[model samples]
Target chain A: DVKVTQSSRYLVKRTGEKVFLECVQDMDHENMFWYRQDPGLGLRLIYFSYDVKMKEKGDIPEGYSVSREKKERFSLILESASTNQTSMYLCASSLGGGPNTGELFFGEGSRLTVL
Target chain B: TQLLEQSPQFLSIQEGENLTVYCNSSSVFSSLQWYRQEPGEGPVLLVTVVTGGEVKKLKRLTFQFGDARKDSSLHITAAQPGDTGLYLCALWAAGNKLTFGGGTRVLVKP
Candidate 1:
């Protein structure tokens, strides 16, 4: 089975502190994404990477940034964490193109709480 | 930007009941997918409907894609406790980005 692993299952950080959430996929998928899931707003895309060193901003990219230094690893960076940033962060990977490109394989998710 | 909207944000019912969830969008999509997420877990893909006016079934669940490719629906029959979870609908947009809906939280009691 394809596996998407998130480094942390839960995290707590102080306001204004820098935060990093890591994700790795073993399937060698070409597209990786970071999304923040909230109660009523759904899963909003923060950033996505189509290649190892290429990244694109998504719908909600104001408070977050991303890095894809390696094909398998994608990291979400919060320059300065705030209370409003507390939410469930999900990482997903999928085939870059072709017939099955739309099917995403997701990680277990990292729940972060900023105090 | 294309947006997908799901209705009935929350639902509660007893086992053996039937229910249906709707997903609507103003823009046309190449395909639509349905996912279910349990507590503490990531959303799992349930079904994908690509053709206009297409219908597919997975056991007790039935999925339909609108003729215009702008909407979809998921119906569950004899829902069990295991069916309790958040159901999300996503659209496969142009840039290979999947635009997700807000989701419907379903709770089934025995």
Candidate 2:
């Protein structure tokens, strides 16, 4: 079984604060993603890393950045958090190239509250 | 940008009832997937349908892909209380990206 672990399950931060959310996958998958889920709006991608030191922005990447210093770890950074950034963050990983590449294994989401 | 529109944003039914959730899109997709998410947890992949007009079954759940690959549907038979959750349809687009629908929240009462 693949395991994707998130560093924090819950977080609280003030506005304009810098926030860091870490994710680690044990399956050694090459693809990792960050998404934020909000009511009515659904889940929107924040950023994704295809390999170590490689990252790409997703649909809603504003006010967010990502770091992929290692193959097993991908991090999401909010340079300056705002109340609008408060939501559930999810991390997922998958095998890089194959017919089943779209199958994503996700970690328990981290709920961040920006006050 | 490609978009997936899911119907019946919310459903409430008694146990042993049958229900279907639909996902429609104007843009063509290479493949589509279904996922179920519980509260406080990330979504889990339920099934993936790639071929046009293809159908797959998992227990009492049935998934079908449109012949044009632009839509999909999930049907649950005799839904149980344990089946209550959010059902989401997603598409695998170019650049290895997965776009998700807004999801349908289902509640099954005992």
Candidate 3:
């Protein structure tokens, strides 16, 4: 079975601190995404990478950035964490981009709490 | 904003009951996906309907996409306790960016 692993399941950080959330997919997928899911509001994409070292901003990308230095790993960085940035962060990967974009394989998710 | 509205934000019923969830939208979608997410875990893909007026079934669950591809529904026969989870509907737009419905949380009492 394909596996997507996340660095942390839960984390706590002070407001204004920098935070990192990592995701690694063993399927060699060409697309990786980071999203924050909040109650009432569905999963809103923050960033997505279609290839190594290439990233694109999604709908909500103001306070977040991403890095895809390796094919299997994608990282989401909180430049400066704020109380409003606390939410359930999810990382997902799809096999490829465009016409054949298959179902996304998701990590267990990381829940961050900014104090 | 491309929005998909899901009905019955929460549903709770006995194990043997039957239920149906609805997902509606005014704008058309090229494809629709259904996902079931357990608490604290990521959402898992249940099925996807691409063509208009398509119907698919997985065991006791039936999914149908509207003729115009602007709506969809999920029906479960003889619900089980294991079916209790969050059901999300997603629509794929032009840029591979998916818009998801508000999601329905179901609880099956045993």
Candidate 4:
């Protein structure tokens, strides 16, 4: 089974503070993604990495950046955390890109609270 | 922008009841997937429907993709308390990214 693990299950930060959320996958998947799940908004992609040191901005990438220094690790960085950024963040990894790659396996998710 | 729409944002029913959730889109997709997520947990894939008008069954749940590959539906038979969770429908649009629906929250009480 594919195991995707997040660094923190719960976190709290003050406004304007920097926040970092980490994700690691044991499956050595080539594709990794960061998403925020909000009520009525679903899971909106924030950023994704296809390979080491490679990143792509998704639909809502503002105020957020990503790092993929290694294949098993993907990190999400918030330049300046705001109250609006308080939400559940999820990380996912997929085996490869193709018709039969299967569904993405996600971590338990990190719940962030901005004060 | 391709959008996946879900109906009945919330549903509450007693055990032994049946319900159907819908996911619709205006654009075509290569495959559609159904997932169930609990609070504080990420969504988990339950079924994946690839062919147009294809139907797949998993235990007490059934998934169907539209003939045009623009829509999908999930039906649960004799839902139980253990079946309570948020259901999400996702689509693979040729690209690597998977677009997900708004999600439907279901609660089944015994």
> What is each candidate's fraction of native interface contacts (fnat)?
0.46, 0.46, 0.41, 0.48
Q: Model 2 off-target regions past 4 Å?
A: A98-100
lDDT per residue, candidate 1, B13-81, as tens digits? Answer: 999999999999988888889999999999999988888999999999999999998889999999999
For model 1, how does the per-residue alpha-carbon lDDT over A1-115 read when each residue is reduced to its tens digit?
8999999999999999999999999999999999999996679889999999999898889989899999999999999999999999999999888533568999999999999
Tens-place lDDT digits, model 4, residues B1-110: 43999988999999999999999998887788888998778899998888999999999999999999888999999999999999999876445677788899999999
Lowest lDDT block of 10, candidate 4 chain A: A94-103
lDDT by residue (B1-110, candidate 2, tens digit) is 33989888999999999999999999888888899998878899999888999999999999999999888999999999999999988877666678789999999999
Could you tell me which 10 consecutive residues in candidate 3 chain B have the lowest summed lDDT?
B91-100
Q: lDDT of each model, Cα atoms only?
A: 0.92, 0.90, 0.90, 0.90
Task: List model 3 lDDT by residue over A1-110, tens digit each.
Answer: 99999999999999999999999999999999898998867788898888999998888999999999999999999989999999999999988858424798889899
Model 3, native contacts kept: 0.41
Query: Which prediction has the highest lDDT against the true structure?
Result: 1
Error of 4 at B64 (Å): 0.8
What TM-score would every model get versus the actual structure? 0.96, 0.96, 0.96, 0.96
- What is the iRMS for every candidate structure? 2.0, 2.0, 1.7, 1.7
Could you give candidate 2's per-residue lDDT for residues A40-100 as a string of tens digits?
5667888988899999888999999999999999999999999999999999998897433
Candidate 1: what lDDT? 0.92
Model 2 lDDT, residue B102, Cα = 90
